[model samples]
Target: MKKFRFALALALTAFVPQGFAQDVQPIDGIAAIVDEDVILQSELDRAVRNITTQYGDRADQLPPVPVLRRQVLERLILVQLQTARAKSTGVRVGEEEIDAALAAIARQNNLTPDQLRQQLAADGLSFSEFRASLSDELAIQRLRQRFAQSSIVVSDGEVDAALANQASGTQYQLANILVALPNGATPEQIATAQDKIDGIKALLDRGEMDFQAAAVRYSDGPNALEGGDLGWRSADEIPSAFTNVVGGMQAGQVIGPVRGPSGFQLLQLRDMRDAAGSGASQNVTQYQASHILVRGDDAAAKARIDALRARVGAGEDFAAVARDGSDDTVTSGQGGDLGWFVHEAFGPQFGDQVSALQDGEVSAPFRSQAGWHIVQRTGTRQTDVGAENRRNQMREMIGQRKLEDEWNRFLREMRSEAYIDIRPAAGVAGVTDGS
Candidate 1:
């Protein structure tokens, strides 16, 4: 069905049968380029129009047109830059990878791949052009992954630096919806739809309905059947329309029945916390720990943990104790050292438990559905200060700084770099209807 929809959309919009080139108005223009990749004015206009026309009405903090333009240009430049680097490094995003990404995008937007394609065309984007967009995104991901491997290590000193510059902060765990009215819907029709949704929300607010059940029944989202679960997204990950609601919300709270492009949306807050309230120091060395099976006998597991505790109490080397009596095979052979890890790499359940233990404090037996188990605090280091856990923040800043310092130096030394060309006829508008 998805494929058929896309094929149908393709047929109607940009398809040229029998291998003839799909026509685009040949506007002689090049907005920017990076080695083999180019960003055209057409792409720029499409992006802007998509943002302003499709998402703008639903936004409370819409960026001014000029600000939006500059951001779009910088991003386009970065895409080209990544393509140049990726090509040089012989990196490519395979078709399977592209298909997987496309599928994920469709799932996110509540459509099948073909349906998404048709929607894009309806909004004036060609499928071929959209494919190019996906290509650029994949290339950038590959390049960033490579760069991150060599450049993203956050040592204790680095974590300290991050903490020193850190200030108080907060964050939210939230999910949302953006409702866009159909092109031909009358004003009265739109209002009626919004009112209907709002009436349902009023019931939810007054405790007359279950949130997830209501969302599942009424939400027009891809995750609707799964109860509108967006899965632990950060405040920054939320669309600006509901940022304020998310940023300030407490756990189990909900907000909205708010105005949107197509109709009304209600945001639900799954959880929230003060970001800096926990005084736990981040400048701590992290060690990886893994445990293996000794399952199906709680009494026996407790006995083993008791014995291990006595051994360590008698001043035996902790690592030696692990090797001698522990069944956590991943660490037992290696003296219980899992590897170097940043604390948060462990999810909340494990992270909270480990964070509370001082170095060398063996944990009490805890029961998870998996089994009865013991956790040991092998070692600690001073690391992961403040927002260092914000994955992209450090590397992006480092990459930009590196470019500023060394790009010109490298350029001066490249004797065989190609000469750039500028043509008089290559100036024009992008591919949009003044979006």
Candidate 2:
């Protein structure tokens, strides 16, 4: 029955054609060139159509089609460049991994994989196209991970500073407008960008234009169409350039023409909240758990794990099983006694499974970064609000902030360094350069 369902999904996907792949293909050409790769006009058309489908009701808030086309084209070029770089660096994602990712996405949306394919067909997207897009996204994520791992490092001093500022607790819901300057901009070009930002600030100051309206018209940042909304971010979450300035502003106030690495930035303080009293405060759950680790490859290991799981399921002692069959020396002799530790002390995969188990409940065998194992949740406790725990949490938060900032800067630098050429589309002005 499962095989039949899988075959039926493939059949549906094969029979359903993409809108652009009809009997008569639309006249298509190159939209942009990134290093050795090309972005096709049809791809751009499809992306624009998808965006329109997503935000059609807010059409007035979107930039003009020509401008939107240029922005989307630039984004495509970046993706192509990143994918190529990832491939060059030997980053690979397997079919099994992609399948797992797809299954996870399906579960998130309350649908099966077959239902997901059918929904994509109904929306005029091919399942193959969807998979390919997912693959590219995953590849880009892997590439970013590699870059972040190599480049970002957090220090104790930075963590101390972050904790010191934690008392402020002020988080800003911000909207931004960026008049972006070209990479390696000349003095005159910098001045021109500044003048453009000043004009935008003037209009915003007099209430002639609202923040969203101004953003849609003039912001160069990617979220311009979404009213340049940065959503709710704490001071630590934001880039340093705007941190000092945002602290002084009140809700509904617009302030900027501030110089940044990218260009001139206009910030509107949409709202503010106290993070200390909010849900963002430092708090965590610690779990007391233990597992029997069976290390071997493929079928043999899986069979051993299956038998062990059955033994435990049939009321055999887990500790006895660990002592006899477990490969981990540290815990096997102690009957798999892992002392109380924060969930994050283990990796996310292990942490997630451990968190889901109730006290005194045993999980079915599951695979983690280490190996396949069954985890027993002996107990759980909430961490108290102690100075040491707070300091540890602050250090983690600061490290995350640094990583995010570094990632953004890395992308900017990547775009600047890549060799790209934008070809003009008929009836649309070409994007000659990126900001």
Candidate 3:
């Protein structure tokens, strides 16, 4: 279950690559293949472009393609898988559901849905695509909750383990100024953005504007209206690129006119804390988990799961297989990788799988909500992989490693059973569902 933590996803934070200087041939990389469908390079690139265009302005740093490829694969696969599962479960997302999700997005960013769309449009994207994407995301979210409600088992022993195993980590709080860049933005346009950020830095230096007010006025991040309060988070929670900027800052210090493919970013460290392992210390506990998805034709999906697990057992690359086959489009490209999970947090099948796995072990294929999964144990840490931290390390190993795979299988089945077909053609104005 190490790789089964579906509930905790890396939120939408990424930097898009520089668009080709001239309109290049339509991207044609074969990122991966899943059964009959293949993930084209263009699709992966576009998704990254979408995330980056909107987040570049706020990100302090962005990773290179090869480095980010796995992550990209994971996310896209999850999206596709979940969308498919939603359809299978007879989960229909109408205009209202789409509207509510959009409203939630707006509220998250402190804007009206119309305003968010206007802003996105200004940046170059179909408001419809965003709506469509949100629907799939929500469907999976609900599916997981339902699974947890019915099957997740938490015990006092698990809680005690969590608290005992929790470790100290560093945390940061910051204010950000994000400037989203549309896909196909030119160098001149990007430079203009950087210069604008420089001006903001100057203004802050001169006490001309405060961080929060500026974020409210100019940042293109989700928390813009809330002054870009990302809340206290651990270093691991942030993009590795920003580690330096966040690491060196003093409270109230403004940092960055950082350059990114999407745009320029400015940041202000508002506060700091050392109690970063709070989740492990306070909230986590062991649970029994089992899941049922409302997605695909269970029989067909199960067949695929059998094939995938077989491949993994035969020494096939788990990440590659996941990227290529997992129905959870959101994270499939990420090689079906889940960052961390606890054993008790996963489904019963997943937990059982974890109990039987050894470090670096890969499981036979399993089915759950999304589709198929070839679960793997990349590595393990018994707290610190040492006797001194054995209890804590074991808990972490249980949570992050053992639970991840099961969670993935659960999600994959859910999404796999879902029925979906992309029009790839036309949509109702401002509506993505083709409704």
lDDT (CA) per prediction: 0.54, 0.73, 0.55
lDDT of 2 by residue, 1-435 (tens): 011122111122111112323232464887767777767777677666655655658777666889777666656666677788889999998898789778877776778989977776665555676677567667777887787679777778887777776657677898889887766789999988888899988888787888897887678886676678888887777767777778888799877678877678988889998766442435568899889888865888889888888989999998999888898899999888898988778788888889999998998888875778888999988876466765676666666667766765666778888877676762244355432
| Top candidate when judged by TM-score against the true structure | 2
Q: Candidate 2 has which clashing residue pairs, if any?
A: none
Q: Which residue segments of model 3 deviate by more than 4 Å?
A: 1-11, 15-31, 48-64, 156-435
Per-candidate TM-scores read 0.36, 0.76, 0.35
Report the candidate with higher lDDT, 1 versus 3: 3
RMSD of each: 17.3, 7.1, 19.5
Leading candidate by lDDT: 2
- Which prediction has more favorable TM-score, 2 or 3? 2
39-64: candidate 1 lDDT, tens digit per residue = 56665555455445434354333334
Worst 10 residues of 2 by lDDT: 1-10
Residue-pair clash count for candidate 2: 0
The local lDDT score (0 to 100) that residue 152 gets in candidate 1 is 45
Clashes of 1: 12
